[model samples]
Target: MGVERYNDLFITEKQKIFISDFNNNVKYFPDNVHFTLAGEISSDPGNLGSGGGWHRDSPYTNQFKTIIYLTDVGENNGPFQYIRGSHKKSGYKLINKVLKEYDYGENRFSDDEILSIVNNIDGFKISTITGKAGDLILVNTRGLHRGAPLTEGTRKAVTTYSFRNKIPNKFYKT
Candidate 1:
């Protein structure tokens, strides 16, 4: 078992086109991109998935991501899961009140906590991304998401994170 990360990856022209259209803006650039191994996880609440528990990236800032699956992923291989429309609800007044004034912007939550929030939020649902090798998943990472705990086999994937503005190298190192 091993873990590794590459700061920024240079992609092909076609890949660039896909990302540009995915963001709906050509001004974005890759801030971080890397492949990692997602192994099985214990049933501990605090130690969940590759991205940890449900959370957003870059805090209040906007970000986009493309995850390319290098292997087959089924129900138990720690597929990436996301809460639909959670990004738009970040500032919804009623949902904020229902959360007891807790802001989830850049916050991580357990399944139970997220479920409670999802139950109350209208039109919110969890989407688990599963696919065969070479499949790619595009996501607005400002929304809530995480890798479901791995049960068997291995999940290998590369995540390319892009942003409208370049972030400092210092932030990427840590």
Candidate 2:
């Protein structure tokens, strides 16, 4: 879906509250927003049908995202998964080092790479977010996250992307 449809779906008071919370928590104004409908019946379980693999939304920048579930999400229905606390400096540095070694482009990480990064992090936890319609999750997209494979039903969700605007530094003569 597009921005208009996303705005329409996000009109309710609860949605407003959630969005407000996201803005406050992330301390940034959202510049871009979008929606997506997934998990239609398909014979082939390709990238489109199965959704994306494990990866960060923005690898270099600190971006914040809020996902609002429009339908019930279960473990078999392509739930959202995240590596907890992976947004911290240490976590990002560790992952960045591994990514550099692999020379991977700005794309999803392979299963082997995911495993290696997770193994390097101390006390890393994987959290699978399964919730009902209207459930909202705010995340630092710099961390490792992905949409799990859908084995049964579909998932409808809207995501808001917020980034910190860069201001040029002005130099002055002494």
Candidate 3:
């Protein structure tokens, strides 16, 4: 994380707000994980439009993410969408069972489809996560989420990942 990275984000006072928290949270990870990448989605006309579908993070061990919204988000502005408490329900056994041969995001399903899988689980709630300019969302790695279309202005955000103490064997090349 450098000053230039903060400059690229269009939020007000994003550097002071996010950096302070980022520095503190960095201590939580074990030696295997390093804070990597600080940038935004480069897709042109870049609001990932509606019904973007459900997906996971990296395919190896479950991952965690911290998202800082540099702008206000609402239903029309493509608010970050996620299911609360979904992370606690997922585990390596279930991940391996469903993805025996397929990779993450490869054999993806629709939100409705995925919701059906866990609909019966207690305390499930899907939402269009709205937040203020400096609000942060802490996400579990295997957490199910996706981009919803923005009806208005661009939704600016910065996302970074966290991993377990040991990098997965498959993350290495042959």
lDDT of 3 at 159: 61
Residue-level lDDT of model 2, residues 66-169, one tens digit each, is 77777888887778898987767677667778667654235478878888777776777678999998888887877878877777767777666554553222
**Residue-by-residue lDDT tens digits, candidate 3, 39-157:** 34323464464325576564444466666776677777767776565554353335435445534444355655555545555455566789887787766646667766666776667
Q: Whose TM-score is greatest here?
A: 2
Task: Write the residue-wise lDDT of candidate 1 on 28-132 in tens digits.
Answer: 543343333323443354346668778877556556777767678778777999877776655345446657867645366667777887888777778899998
Model 3 residue 157 distance off true place after TM-score fit, in angstroms: 0.7
lDDT of each: 0.65, 0.66, 0.56
- Model 2, poorest ten-residue lDDT window? 165-174
- lDDT-based ranking, best first? 2, 1, 3
Error of 1 at 24 (Å): 7.0
Candidate 2 overall lDDT versus native: 0.66
In model 2, state the lDDT of residue 42: 26
Note the residue pairs that clash in candidate 2: none
Clashing residue pairs in candidate 1 are none
Which candidate would rank higher by TM-score, 2 or 3?
2
Worst 10 residues of 1 by lDDT: 1-10
